[model samples]
Each structure stands twice: as structure tokens, then as C-alpha cells.
Target: MAIAKTSPSIKYSFPPFVPDGARLIILGTLPGEESLRLQQYYAHPRNHFWPLIAALAGKRMPSSFAGRVALLQGNRWALWDVLEGAERIGSSDAAIRNPTPNAFGKFFSKYPDITSVAFNGQKAHDLFRRYVIKPGIVANDRLTAIDLPSSSPLHTIPFEEKLAVWHDRLAPYLPPKPQNRRAK
Candidate 1:
């Protein structure tokens, strides 16, 4: 019998997608399988994240990746993951281990305009509360932090229900809906 060799998979997070004049940072757990492969956040077509954002901000979900990012940045929003890297078998947040949190203290210092942290899911919130907050890298009093419902399709909630909760918590942070301009 021959033994096979296998190495542990260590996935790393991408650089934060923070644009200038950003006021709110939305953090998620590690990218899922499809997202990692696609090299974009919420790449899964089934994910509600982009649609929710579009509906909330009164904008259309753009077709291109750059457009999607610009939409958020234009709205004074930022996006990133809670961990710098982690050892996980797959996309399951529960299976995550050896989590290395991002350098939040440095991030906060560099981006003073960021006044709030909106967690994209419960997993991100728990991880930040444990690794980032417990280590004293960031003080809860320093920023308004809210745990929004997970935008994952696996969450099994109606889109409207999730949108309602998201709107309630994040409307203040999001830019106002665009006004329809009519032809003169």
C-alpha cells in the first residue's frame, strides 16, 4: 500500500476595498468557494449581498466587478474580511481554524474617516469580537458596530425580510436613493 501526501490549505484574504472618504466598513468572513475562485466578494450569483445593496441604495446592480466596487465606494462604504488568513477545509465558517485577524489598529489609524463597522454575518461579528476586540486592537466605543444578517444564500431567509433588517440598520450609512431624471 502507498501513502499519499497532502498539505493543509491556507487561504488568505484580499486587500481591503476601501475607497477615499469611506465612512462605514462592512466585514465578512472568508470568501466562499465561488467567491475565492472568482476573486470577488459575493461572486455567487445566488448571494443576496449585491441585490440587497442595490435595493437599499436605490441603484442597479452593475454587471461588472469594477462597477460593483465603485457602487459601494461611491456610497462612502468599504469592504473587507475579518481575518487576514485562516486554515479551513472549505467555505464553511464553522470549519475555520487558525484564524489570524487583520491589523485593525493600523487600519483604523490609517482610515480615520471610518466611523462604523457593519458585520456582514454573525461569523464575522463573533470573530472580530473575539480576536480584534478581545486583543484591544479596537475599542467598541471608538466605532459603531452592528451585526447585520448574513447575505449568504444558505441563510434561508426571505429576501425581503433580510432587506428589511438591513435597511433598518444600514440605511443611515448608505447613500440616498437616486432621483429619476426625466428628459427635458
Candidate 2:
């Protein structure tokens, strides 16, 4: 009798956080173990994603999940994953298999104002280029892909360096500094 090999379970990505008037959509490969457990994107404590967003927007980092979501949405930013689901025993993108991309065609149609698709890392960018560029899926005339440094602690680039890279490439799409409102 031969012993059978078992494959990893299929992990599903979280629903997108596309808000009204969203102009930019940030895509990660998929949420990691911690994120999945927390049911939030980039939930890992060491992840630099929230800090980067706060720094870029010139705002204090929001601590609560709802507050964080509001911060990004208020800035006209959306968040999602490149792969809707993938089979992987671990959180490593390299180990991902049987990947299925999100519904870009319908998403693009519904959210026609989105001008930029920002990938959180090289893997996410590559996957988008490979799977999300189907006919009528992306409005090429309006959509531009922006490569962003990964906020994962596993990524080698330093936090400050990553900030610089994102500031350089994504300055236009990132949320601008909030205006101060004086009491009337």
C-alpha cells in the first residue's frame, strides 16, 4: 500500500474594501496567517503597511480596525488581494498553488473611477500582470500599475527605504495630507 500525499488547504482572501470615490486600489498577494486569524489585512504586528499609510497621508496611525478602514477609505484608497483563493500550507507566496484571481472585470466595471492599481510587493504585481489582464478586465486607458515595496517583515528592505520608494512612485495616488479645520 502506498501512502498518499495531502495538499494544503485552500485559503480564501478577504472581501475588498472598495469605498466610494476610490481612485487607488492596493493589492497584496494574500493575507498571511495572522491576518487570516484576525480577519484583517496586514494584521501582523511587525508589518509596516499601516504605518506606511499613515506616514504617507501625514496622519497618526489608527489603532482600531474600523478606524483604519475609515482612514484608507477617507483617503480614496481601496484594498484587496491579487489571488481570491490559493492552496498553500503556509503564508509564503512562493508556496501558493492553484491560484484564482479576483473578479477584475466586474470590479473595474463597477469602480470605473479607479485610476491606479498598486501592488504591495513584486509577487502581487507579477500575479496581476499574469492573471488580471484579461479582455475587458482592466481599462488600460485609465489604469496604471504602481509597484510598491512590501510591508511584510519578511521583506528585506528597511522601513524607511520602503517609505522613500512608495513616496517616490505612489505620491500621486496616495492620499494627500489632511487639511486642518478651524472651529467656526
Q: Backbone collision count in every prediction?
A: 0, 0
Residue 115's lDDT in candidate 1: 84
lDDT per residue for candidate 1 within 1-184, as digits (tens), equals 9998555588888889988889999999888878889999989999999998888767798999888888787778999999999888767788788999989999999998898999988999999999999889998789899888999988889999999999999888877666999999
Query: Residues 17-106, candidate 2, lDDT per residue (tens digit)?
Result: 998889899999988989999999989989999998888777799999887787787778999998999999878898899899999888
Best by lDDT: 1
Model 1 worst lDDT window (10 residues)? 5-14
**What TM-score against the true fold does each predicted structure earn?**
0.90, 0.88
The C-alpha stretches of model 2 lying farther than 4 A from their native spots are 1-6, 134-136, 139-141, 175-184
When superposed on Cα atoms, how far off is each prediction in RMSD?
Answer: 2.8, 3.2
Model 1: residue 72 alpha-carbon error in angstroms: 0.2
lDDT on C-alpha atoms for all candidate structures: 0.89, 0.87
